[model samples]
Target: MKDNKQLAGPRRDTIETFEGHENTILAIATFPDGERIATGSRDKTIRIWRLEDGRETKKWGVKMIIGALVISRDGKQVVSSEGPELGDDEDDDEDKVLSRFYQWQLWVRDAETGRVVAGPLDGHTNSVFALDVSLDGSILASGSADRRVILWDTTTWRRNGDPLLCGAPIACVRFSPAGHGQLGIATDKYIQIWALDRRERLAQIKGHTNYNGSCNLSLSWTRDGARLLSAGNNYDPVIRSWDTSTWEQVGDPWSGHDADQHIYRIILNPAGTLVASASSDNTVRLWQLSTGTEVARYEHSDDVLRVAFSVDGRFVFSGGLDKKISQWEIPDDLLTTARGDPLSGRLKIETTSFNSPHKHQRQASAARGKQKARVYISQSMYILTVNQNLKSHLVVCGFMITTSMFLRHF
Candidate 1:
């Protein structure tokens, strides 16, 4: 299972590459069937792909940059958290109103047609960074840079409650996957668990921070909803978890990921024993949840932004700054390798495959600080700016940004 199927080796294989995203891939969500996936890119389009042959199935052009994406449990809807493309001209009041119109909005689209069924579901005044569907598909929770968590009724696509205020910008939000009726709200230093039925914070666990203080970037819930894990950026380059039922710290912080690099996501496998982390260190690292051990790692050419496990837990798909979705099959002896010993995870693809030669050249140009591009929108005169650094490649045209636009993630 070498990177190239033809290569003669027993290493884990890179099975398929889902290509088509024109910009940095910001989000990826696996469909219920496990054979298809929906990915959101800074390209402002969500493309659905069939995993078998990496064929594009459907695409939806969105008005704003994608922040995060999640599919309803029933697989009938695709809900995406999108942020605004900032405008330069903000001196006039009329222009101000127009700018507010485009800021962080949520869109719920029909899974089959990719048509907007409901939204510009607006409530948060700032960029929405996270979105998660409840276990029953009845509640949709959104966390935002505005430092709030808002809930909406899936049945009516309407806000269900007032915003839950936090001390800092919310980096991620996830409903307990175990049907525990709890929502985990993550910020820089705290992971608060709220009881959905009571609409009150049930538990608040703090004190987990990385070298640079903290910037919690993502969260994951165990399949049984017993453990809630949180991840932060480079300075705080470690993953910490809590026992949901007791609201107590679970284990020693899991750390073999390179320091001073953002762990964009840390997704738990369906079995809930393995943790696959997508990192800015240009690699996807797998860890054992029970022992905090580095089991396997997949090398990527550029910063890895997102990671997702298939429904059946046999394959792992990752997408990122490379703009390509690389599918890696889990090693056959996932749990039995060296009797599940240390550093046995088996992916070794080094260079990333690009969709076009122009993409390769653009990246080279970017390294030399001469790369730039634009997306024309006849509706407004905002000029899109290409990100040229370690953070997300976001669009900041002439649109009005009230708070001087924050970094794409933090």
Candidate 2:
């Protein structure tokens, strides 16, 4: 099936807008039922919204800026974390001495009743950058700036074991999609798979170079738990798929973006055939998993910090520095268009032309040599002109004209 044509659907709609955040939104989490959307902002608050109406359902204030957010698998709990803060001092000498104590807290809340269920989990000694919940909703995993990953029992609200050690700050963490006791972790340059049952490092795949300061931004397990994907802060953005059985790199890295775009998040569609990436370049690119080919690139005016696919995988919700939540529909037709040749299939290029303020007319003159020609499509007509012909071009370019039209349809 050639998925080349743009999917025909309603234009994107603004579902809801939340006010009160003084800074950019950092992270967002959606409930399993798709009824509630939770957002963590630099304003030190987590706001819950009704997905249908975009109305503010609830808001909880934290002491510091929240960097990560996650909802439990059962949609009954939420976990949020703030970066570490400084301690208070009493005397002048004590105040002059800086104390470097770092702390992370996880707050579990009831999704429907808006009640705090468990904590303020205070275990990690640094900023909590990533959080994930198990399929059974009984286990929670957290990655932190202190170079550790921790598993917590959701029911008992206790640590599962000694924190999984790492060489660098853990940037992302996720549970296996098969509902098994397997987890994935990403740091600066390594992707590590750990077995939850044995509490042992299963495999570590390392080859990619790390960005100077930023770490890998996202990790996801394929639906069947047979593969894993990782995206990060390199100029050559890669979507690496690894076999779950042997933990080997299964295929070539998906590389299309040449600009130094940092991928902030990656989510595989429920069908396991499509993968979507939210990036720093203010766009979301969707790719086919089997072929590692780009399907569509959704553009935004500002940086896209996070993105999530609906449970049915028909719509994508993206949030970013713009402080607006935009919903994009993934039409079957657009997917069809993307699968075909973009350059030769129904080519459409929109351009603008402005004539000089002065009006002038020149005779039709022919150049001596036949040079390579390029076609420029304006709003109304196709401009078949040579680049080096100066006298003919300068004489007739005097009127300022504006036009708007489509290129082709078939």
Candidate 3:
């Protein structure tokens, strides 16, 4: 059911805790369909979750602890970095004698049935640290401990070209949000930008330093691909955004997480307006990307390892040592798009325009800045009504119109 209440004070964000994984949840990815999510955990199993209700829809096992996961653009296939690892040299058991041998490579599987569709794509010689699929799902990028970032052609599930070599082991890799033409690769010391389409290294950014050397940082591209965001851990626990065009830092590094823990991962919501960070401090936090202002926080039982956003940007999913995926409800009235901007089309514009205040409404919105804005929309009328201090603040002569009339204007 939709929440329509216009209450006072800060928005009350609620969370639904989902329990399933036996070990720490290491990675999370939302299905393009928005109805489901895929969570990868140290338990060596990936579980499908229904978003409408906290239901574990499906499950599949892999050979090693899942390091990363990305769903194909069509929402049909899930690409995961999987493989086995050795414990102490004296401890010969793979999983304490679990599995003696297994291949460590990227696996592309069917989203519905968990069937391998294209790969055990092989190239990297070590643990896979990152995986990202292009917007069109025509290409896939995988970064590994071997210091190689390999691009694969999704159609043939084959290596697209020679691996993108780096000076140090790769911590993460991401395809630009705007398209597949550009890629970002990170090592402990610096982040390298590459023009993937031309097979050339563009520039290297040294904005972040990973103190612990775990190579556990993350990278994300802004919606337009004009900027890139990166975060690291240990002594250098901070989130940094950079301009892709100039490869320049955007603003001061964002800091809120505990100084001693690692920020496992960071992702931007679909609208690219909000940033969500998962950390070892046992909390997932949401921030305004433009201002770096901390917006909301969700607590976990243990270290939070990964976070994801629904395609609609209405909800956020976080998972970690708690062995669960938490679904958080974004405030209904919190505008998803930029302030004072209308949605792209009539259907979407109405939802956005109603939230964003126009120049004429600035004076009325100033006082409501510290308060939540409630929007009332119906087929009968489009009214700019705001609720605050338990009273209605109506702008523009306090008038409302029918839905058809509103549609005609947009």
Which structure among the candidates has the greatest lDDT? 1
Best by TM-score: 3
The TM-score that candidate 1 achieves is 0.75
* Per-candidate TM-score against the hidden true structure: 0.75, 0.72, 0.76
Lowest-scoring 10 consecutive residues by lDDT in candidate 2?
A: 390-399
Which parts of model 1 have CA positions greater than 4 angstroms off?
1-13, 87-102, 210-212, 245-248, 335-410
State each model's CA lDDT, in order.
Answer: 0.69, 0.64, 0.68
- Cα distance off (Å), candidate 1, residue 310: 0.8
Candidate 1 local lDDT, 1-410, one digit each (tens): 11222211223557789888898898899876456799998899999998778899998998767988998765678999887655635565786755664477898999889888998788887777688877556788998877889989999999887778777778788876544467888887777778777678888766355345767788887654657888878877788877776866777888766767888888877545688989887778787777767777887888999999876566789999999999998786764442332221121112232222121111111121232322211111111122222122322221211222211111
What tens digits encode model 2's per-residue C-alpha lDDT throughout 301-371? 67788887664456677777877666677777644443331221122232233441111111122222332
Better of 1 and 2 by lDDT: 1
Writing each residue's lDDT as its tens digit, candidate 3 over 18-72 gives 7888987878888654567899988999899887788999999887788889887
